[model samples]
Target: MVLKKLVRYIINKYLKDYIEQLDYEKLKLDLKNGHVCLENLHLKPEALTDLSLPVTVATGCLEKFTLIIPWKNLYSMPTKVQIDGFYMLIVPKNGK
Candidate 1:
């Protein structure tokens, strides 16, 4: 239960703003393989708000995303991120 809470906290802290839709029920975590998989995520329009950009994301979708963490060599090895089928549409806030 503690581990699950930690994972949820991390996700919420790091990804909640950017991810508009995330089905926690479908989240997959393979501890032995050190792999975390997320699929069919929709990005929020405010994803770029911190960037202070003039454009907005009209639509965004991530088909799949994978994070590979090396637990054994967590300090020595760099984490890897794999993103597939990421689509985004950006338009000017003024509709230009």
Candidate 2:
């Protein structure tokens, strides 16, 4: 499956790099059925506030790409998330 291949590539490239920057004791990634699951993740409060809240991404898999960001990391900011093809973006809401 091409989607499976893409997922594997993503895991090997971006995901691995992202995980390496995180504290191992706070986060873990699990791969199953061509999906990547992030478990027991923790993010800094300041990081959350500065984060691009609305995230967007595309997946050809039968399952949706899920990102479980902790509430403490949300910071009640309006987020604009958009997904188009292979592109994803998380940006501050512009009151639209």
Candidate 3:
């Protein structure tokens, strides 16, 4: 239980910059197998800031986000990431 909270805290802290209104209730973490998943994530316009594009995201959402880590073989195997049902609405910046 404590580990779950810690994981949640860490994820929320790092993801806050990109995700808007991230639903913690929907987060699932399995430390035993090193799996993390989040569903129905809404994204903020600033989420794309690092991309440095001339457009902005008017709205965005992801149905599912998953991360898998091979804890047993941490050094041998590669971590995996999967995103599903990603939807985004983009618009050009006024000045750009």
Candidate 4:
């Protein structure tokens, strides 16, 4: 049905714009609360500041696996969403 396709297109567009601040690839929308949630979403790693390290050393670091950033920090960061009082909740994706 044409309506189905249109709805898909709208949701997809909304997702693309929403996740621009996040490094996640997948998301789901909760229509009841108008909340978009991404499981196991990774806050993008800090930009590489130096390139001198060998590839093996880079991959072996634990920071690559997990970061200790706080939940409050995420809500403070800028996002494309302009609505007032937008909120966020970050839990370990799949209890990681």
Candidate 5:
């Protein structure tokens, strides 16, 4: 259940109320590669309680750690928070 704990910890720390309706088929954490992959990820629109909450909440989470999207922004989100063990690389579908 370590994976579950890890996933929950990350979600709770970053996602907050959005977790209730977050949909993803898999949570794959590769320790050796220092990456977390959330496959088939999407959010159910109806579950969102507040529209502005997501925007501000997102900034809050990003403030805490380095966010890598597209796998191309990897080198930019400040190396201080980009600790290999702390960041998550959210490689969006087809690199979109």
Candidate 6:
């Protein structure tokens, strides 16, 4: 009925707004050297597959390590979301 439709519409709107707010807050967090939890988001597939050889070599040369942890490994339960890149690079600060 009309009431059911209205309720559905309101729920959808609230979900959308909540997702946007989460994204904004996440952007403000210091991702550097900190792990990011992407439990309910989907990322581009290309970014997941594409690897730059030069970058890898440079990192190796500089003795820096890059770790890619699958989302499932970080989370206890399987989520409905698939991230573009399952893992995020956490670069340490110069002095740290």
Say which candidate scores most in TM-score. Answer: 1
Better of 4 and 5 by TM-score: 5
lDDT of 6 by residue, 20-50 (tens): 2223222211124232232333222222223
Residue ranges of candidate 6 with Cα displaced over 4 Å: 17-96
Q: Model 3, which residues run further than 4 Å from truth?
A: none
Residue 51 lDDT (model 5): 45
Estimate TM-scores for all models: 0.90, 0.24, 0.85, 0.23, 0.36, 0.19
Instruction: List the pairs of residues colliding in candidate 4.
Output: 40-93
* Candidate 5 vs candidate 6, TM-score winner: 5
Number of the predicted model whose lDDT against the real structure is largest: 3
Error of 3 at 82 (Å): 0.9
The CA-based lDDT of model 6 is what?
0.31
User: Candidate 4's residue-wise lDDT over 1-96, tens digit each?
Assistant: 553345346545644433324433443443333344444322222222244322211111111212122334557754233223223332222222
Q: Ten consecutive residues with minimal summed lDDT in candidate 6?
A: 56-65
- List lDDT for all candidates, in order: 0.85, 0.35, 0.88, 0.34, 0.39, 0.31
Question: Could you tell which candidate, 1 or 3, scores higher by TM-score?
Answer: 1
Per-residue error at 48 for model 6, in Å?
Answer: 21
Comparing 3 and 4 by lDDT, which wins? Answer: 3
1 or 6, which is superior by lDDT? 1
> What is candidate 1's lDDT per residue for 1-96, written digit by digit as tens?
675566667777889999976677877888678888889999999898899999999999999988788989999999888899999999888744
lDDT of 2 by residue, 1-96 (tens): 564455446544744422223333432333232224434332222232334565322211111233333334356643222222322233444455
